[model samples]
Target: MPNPPRLRATALTATAVLLCPLLAGCGGDDPKDPDLTAQKLSWKDCPAPSAPEGGGAAPSPLPNGGRWQCATMKAPRDWSDPKAGTIDVALIRVRASGGKSQRIGSLIFNFGGPGGSGVTGLPAFADDFAELRTRYDLVSFDPRGVGRSAAVECKNAKQLDTYLQVDMTPDDAAEERKLLDGTESFNAACEKNSGAMLPHVRTTDAARDMDLMRQVLGDRKLYYFGISYGTELGGVYAHLFPKNVGRAVFDAVVDPTQNPEQGSLGQAKGFQLALDNYARNCVSMAEGCPVGDTPQDVKNRIAVLLKNLDAKPIPGIPPRKLTQSLATDGILQALYSQELWKYLTQGLYQAYQGDGKVLMLLADSLNGRNENGEYSNLIPANVAISCADDKPRYTVKDVTAKLPEFRAASPLFGDTLAWEMLSCSDWAVPGAAYHPNVSAPGAAPILVIGNTGDPATPYEGASRMVKALGKGVGIELTYKGQGHGAYISGNKCVRNAVDAYLLQGKTPAPGTVCS
Candidate 1:
């Protein structure tokens, strides 16, 4: 299972394509490189995504006939030492539909994997933001150590296939050793493959890159949209460059206050809440719930299925069996969006019948594996950036000690997540801090949207972010809905409020609630 911090919007989209039809300088003075900043980006037609980017054909044109263009911006490899060598940061954008005078400059987006390729993300969901594109250029990029921006490669496809199958929730000493050995091996692979880029992949370094990107795009202030982990990045950017903040919105807000352990624990509760909601929805449906007669019954059946898989794995995709770990990952993926709920039901129905293809497919999506059996740098970069940003490293004892608390948090997810605390173990680079500092005291009012039922980031994170962003700097908008994000949930109120803020510069009333 992926660490709970990962947001699956882009990955989930990748899954749909397979099933469907074919498809910084450390703070201080702010590094300055006149030549690099003044250099012009040579925007051209985008080519098919590379293997590291989760390979696919180049993005198609927009509905308005505006072509999606790609480019690369140069930035220092290490922000702390601007004099160091440079690296390419891949970018993608489409011009605004509105007249030149009406254009409000570029509106950059970060779809929050810390590892997700904004280059692919912007185009995948371009239609949803077409309105924002009317007045602003829709722009996004592959941050360093992600996608084509000097991607961090680790275990190859074949190796990852085996690594991902290891029992993450080990029950005995031998099983625990296997889990630890696998983790160390994976971490070692990352060091062997991408050691040069490891230390510089921290959030602080990425934040610096964004400021340079702002200057290169000729935008006086950044007009931005961030989701999930992107929210954390945006907050860090705001803190580092409060004066440069423009109209920014953070949806599916991450709590800037929690350390990795607290964040993981919160996800345990959050996902459990979402599961409860999913069960209730299942039983209340007009067609009637097929999985179980009652909410608790549905959960009970799932528990039994998982326990059974742990003991005797079920046949999944050819050559691989659906183990308890993969099944849990598949379930987590389906729970990201309400639209995926039907697929979850279908997967569960098939699993009960001893066919694990659907569930395996879902797990494959989460792990960045496509139908072709190729892997993307998503998981690798996720671990790299997360380890670089998080300070704590766990031991087998640390995880075992916390198992009870984690299981108490969510019998379904606690163990898996607790075990994940060891993801940074034996990492190549030391982490920056316990938690990110998102205190942007003087930044412009950032519209923070939180979904009441968000599983990954949780709703309380909205208020926490608002507080962290400081007085008058953060605006909270509550969306009483489901899913990992609010705006993408297709809620009209959210769209209108966000559109009003980003397009017209009209900040929604603080503490605004949209149901």
Candidate 2:
């Protein structure tokens, strides 16, 4: 579920532990220093962006749906070494939908992936984000290694399939060997296929690309909305070019300093926490709830069921086979959205009855498996980006040493999740592994938002980011509900507050708590 990684603060000590050396990189120079001049530009005075030379005047309306047009911008591949190679960024703009008089310049949005596609995000959110669209043109583009732009692609699907097939929770040496060997093969393939682009896909490089997009749009500043992993990109942007940031919102922010090794392990714990939440409030209910009284009971039952599936997987299902592994695979897929919680309930009901068919369907969904035996491009893209962006601070021995803690933190999925990082163990590029202090000297303090009950991005992540930014205030918006990405999801208070901030340059009062 960690498509990309985002912001927030908390009341509890939240236990910010450097518990592992892998998680130890967050310790560095404090980066909070605001730029007063940029902060002073009220929403009214913000400059409007002009169309690029090739694109037509007046953002055009599209036949299919949301307005779309192509635009291009130039940026330094490495900002510090300004004379470094130049990269061309391709952009797609969706003009706002409200009264023309109320039009604002641009509101750039990112779909969370250290390498996610932002090209179609605006259109996807067109209806839900009507308010945001009215005043500002929703702008997004392919970050380096993303859509319609020069993307980083892996040509070896077979090797990747082997890695994906590896047992997430290896029970013995034989399985472990398979995991290690598959990992190495995938790594070799990436290195062999992706050369220079692999290293450059890091979150920092993507942020620099955004700054160039701003200049191309001809806006003196940027109005942004970043979710999940997009939050980290936005944070790095705020840290590097604060002067160019206008009213920015980072919802579900990841602490950039926390690299993938620690972050994924921590995420394993977060997922278990979410499972606990679902078991408590969702399971015992009359309609769709899956479990018998206790959360532990449900978990124990699931374990037994998975063991059975592993030993004797259901028979042939065409090109893609369904085994005990795929049944458990379905469970992980159901965790992505609360909307699918009912599906989980139903799958569990069937699973308890020893019917693995339904669960296989669910797993197929999660694994990006389609009905025609085809798989989604998401996983391939995910592996490439995640492996590239995160530094494996832990070695195989390092991971083994922490098994006890991982298990304690996440019994059902921790070991599997922890082992997931092995994908990068054999990666071709030893990523720069540099975590910079992102607080720019003169950037406006961007609003970092977090939801209390988000399953994918734990509330603690937001708290860590808000605290790290030092000066920026953390706005805790209690959805008191479920699902990920809550900003445009209809919590009136949250929406109104966000709208006011982007449209009027208003920051919710310090320590603002919205429910």
Candidate 3:
């Protein structure tokens, strides 16, 4: 709700980065309400979850290669009072078969989103980290309002269907008014339906929940592996309980203090950087690129393509529902992961040929619209989390004033991106004050990773976070790469450096540049 692109990853929606007054400004439930406390958990009391009733054999290896189990542990909704109301945190545990007792401990993985499902990612890294798992239990969970846990379900998935289908970026005043009205309407719906849960969905609250999860897991100190917004979570934990931290790896880190407006501008620039990287590998090559050699050339072509689609929404594959906006959404999604850049290039290439199928598929995937016409809860959760975390900075006048600058920076994606949050400006749940500095002075050495050309979390952000921590080390694994949160995905030099730190408490030598 805040700006879609900026708040997207952090706030449940991954819109844009938004900063606000304070949790108190969220305005719903009383902050002093004793019932809403986040209670910390203790290991001795965190009973091991029950296995499946049938105790059937394990399933086949997963795409990322690992076996997974549904596990649960109880923690109080509020940590300050352990005796308060308890909630069950659904977890996915992937144990390592090779390492055995030498296991270092459990490593909790959070993939940002304040809503992203780390549980679903367990298998993706299972095979590669088999050794690590042998010694340590790899755990991921559905943070509150996320997957599997007591999810905050929006109106029947059908309404969400309608929500995702709406276009937020409009060209004319009439369309613009429609976009603004739609946003306020959606915000109202969430507030009325979600009730008290709306105000309590902040990152700070989520971090507190993580601390409780840590205690329930029975770890004296916490070890974490977080990506994107996950970095914020780890930072918050380190800040709250530095002494309780063990080994923390924050890849694709973000500086929570940044203003969403400036950050979005910076991100647009970062996207340009990534686009340049993609062009280097894509344009002027034998394979062929979707756009032309010059980045401006590509921008011009996309603008044309979007206009064509805007005038006539192409019927995409059955479920993706290919609209111009959806296509843009897909392109942005793939931009987050460079591995998919080729497909985008191919899709763009094909779209230039009047075949919107590939682009539509890519877009569908980005939109998380399944083949069955059912979308993953990604978009809605993205909105819910973001709106709850922060309010949008609005005023038709303010956004209009910045239009020229934004458009100049991003010819193709600028105006659309700028207007992506007309909905959150009037959001019922506003944000709390922005705390620029969130550092863990006494926490164990926290490892911060940054790729020089990361399309998502810019390199500067990682640098800022490391500097702010003051005690932690920033490992510049110059993959000289593009994409988001793929540490341990591949790249031996980078993987080994991270592996050594997690496996053994060895931090990469200062400013170590791997690969």
RMSD of each: 2.9, 8.8, 6.5
Task: Identify the leading candidate in terms of lDDT.
Answer: 1
Off by over 4 Å in 2: 1-66, 71-88, 155-162, 288-293, 315-317, 323-329, 351-377, 434-436, 472-479
Estimate the lDDT of model 1: 0.85
How many clashes in candidate 1? 3
Q: Which residue window of length 10 is worst by lDDT in model 1? A: 20-29
Q: Model 3: how far is 355 from its true place, Å? A: 3.7
110 Cα displacement, candidate 1 (Å)? 0.4
What tens digits encode model 2's per-residue C-alpha lDDT throughout 322-355? 5555665566656545656677777777767656
Per-model TM against the reference: 0.97, 0.80, 0.84
Per-residue accuracy of model 3 over 174-286 as CA lDDT, tens digit each: 87776677666666666677655665566666666676667666677788988887887777767766677898888877756676566566666666677667766766677
Which candidate, 1 or 2, would have the higher lDDT against the true structure? Answer: 1
Clash count per candidate: 3, 18, 38
Error of 2 at 253 (Å): 1.9
